[model samples]
Target: MPMNLLHRMLCRSALWERTSATRIVPWALTGLDLGAAALEIGPGYGANVRTLASRTGALTGLEIDPGLAARLRDRHGADMTAVEGDGAAMPLPDSAFDAVVCFTMLHHVPSAAVQDAVFAEALRVLRPGGVFAGSDGLDSRGFRLLHVGDTCVPVPPDTAAERLTRAGFTDVDIETGTTSFRFRARRPAA
Candidate 1:
């Protein structure tokens, strides 16, 4: 079935929050020490991009939706560089970002392999010792109201950790709250 306007707006809002909230607080708490450059995949409405841009030395936002990407660029102006692109195949080179953040975009990727590709791309762009963090709603009774692109993605903590490990991230940390599962993983320092 086609999504109504309200559903579309809700999905977009949730996506923005899922991708931004998980990282924002932790980043702020850690003093936003992300190095020279950072990247946010599927930045949705650019909430994460705004925060990261303010904290990091430089920030890039990649969004598949042209409309949203344009809006992000306009909104963020010089604080961030917005790109129209796919997360699975990023336009940036390996180790381009000191940190990579992805919100609730994995499940909307449509296939497990694509999700893996996105995760791998995130790892590829991250510098050694860099961090990647994301959050998504879990399929708990309380979170039944949570939605991602019209459906729920059951993001269990263990499964998210496994995925991060498979994507070459070490020191995986998974945290769960009442409504969401948050995963933070780091690339090893050489």
Candidate 2:
């Protein structure tokens, strides 16, 4: 499904802003080098761009929504580039970025297979020793209600570290909160 008005509002709300700033951003950036290049997959409203841009030497966003991607290009034009693309099958080059991160959109993928594909793609794009990190809502009743029919297969934090490891990542770490979880892992060094 496309990004509707309700989704846009939710992404831009104060609660969303705080959550991204405090919990998500810090966790995702846990072990990343601020001077390295980074890419964010499925950035619904580019909510994570500002923080990521401020830290990373170069930043790009891969958004599924063409219109939203264009808007992101306009809004954060100087800080980063925003391209329209799919997470499971990106058009990007291999080992191009020092880091790859995603927000709560993994569950929005059509299937668990696609979600796993996204993790593999994320690992594939990371340079050796680079980070692949992100956060997502827990499969709680509230989260399910909010996402409604949009969520495909919610990945609980308990399984995230293993998933990352299976996708060729190392040093996997996952922190689960009451209704959300953050994860970070690194591609093996050469």
Candidate 3:
């Protein structure tokens, strides 16, 4: 997904990191345990990576952009693994992680079909009973403005549960705020 200059700048800002640490990450991962191994679908600018790394035993960030992936590896390789890959078709092993998550990056997948593929991939890579959770910006004026020249196809919260279910996840839950939405679901142990 291509992000405009302003959007890129905003994502890399200190304010974004603070918000991710104090609010977004907390809300997205509430009441869930990431366990020993966790995978982050898209770790843009590592805004949420620091908090995520602290909570899980090991964190692997799957980034679509090669440059960003390299940068992440360079900056946080000691703490987390950063691999260049797509969320819809992750280059990881099946049933390999205790948790898989993405944050504010779904809409960048270009279309709903691709987003669903990402969901399926998440399920495929997670261990039974593993959690798949994330948060994304809802359609809003500010959100639209922020994505001016970027690939933005907002996910409708109303249909998220169904989509997650179709992707073979159970206990799907979605919560929408004024500007964003959070979703949590788990792969059935049986």
lDDT of each: 0.72, 0.80, 0.93
Per-residue alpha-carbon lDDT of model 3 for 41-109, expressed as tens digits?
889888887899999999999999998998898888887899899999999999999999988999899
- What is the C-alpha lDDT profile of model 1 across 6-98, one tens digit per residue? 645764585655645565445432533667898878777666655666668988988888888899888876888899999988988988888
Instruction: Count clashing residue pairs per candidate.
Output: 1, 0, 0
Alpha carbon lDDT at 155, candidate 1: 51
lDDT of 2 by residue, 116-147 (tens): 89999898888888888877778877766676
lDDT of 2: 0.80
TM-score winner, 1 or 2:
2
Off by over 4 Å in 3: none
Q: Which ten residues in a row have the lowest lDDT in candidate 2?
A: 1-10
Assess every candidate by TM-score: 0.81, 0.91, 0.98
lDDT of 2 at 114: 84
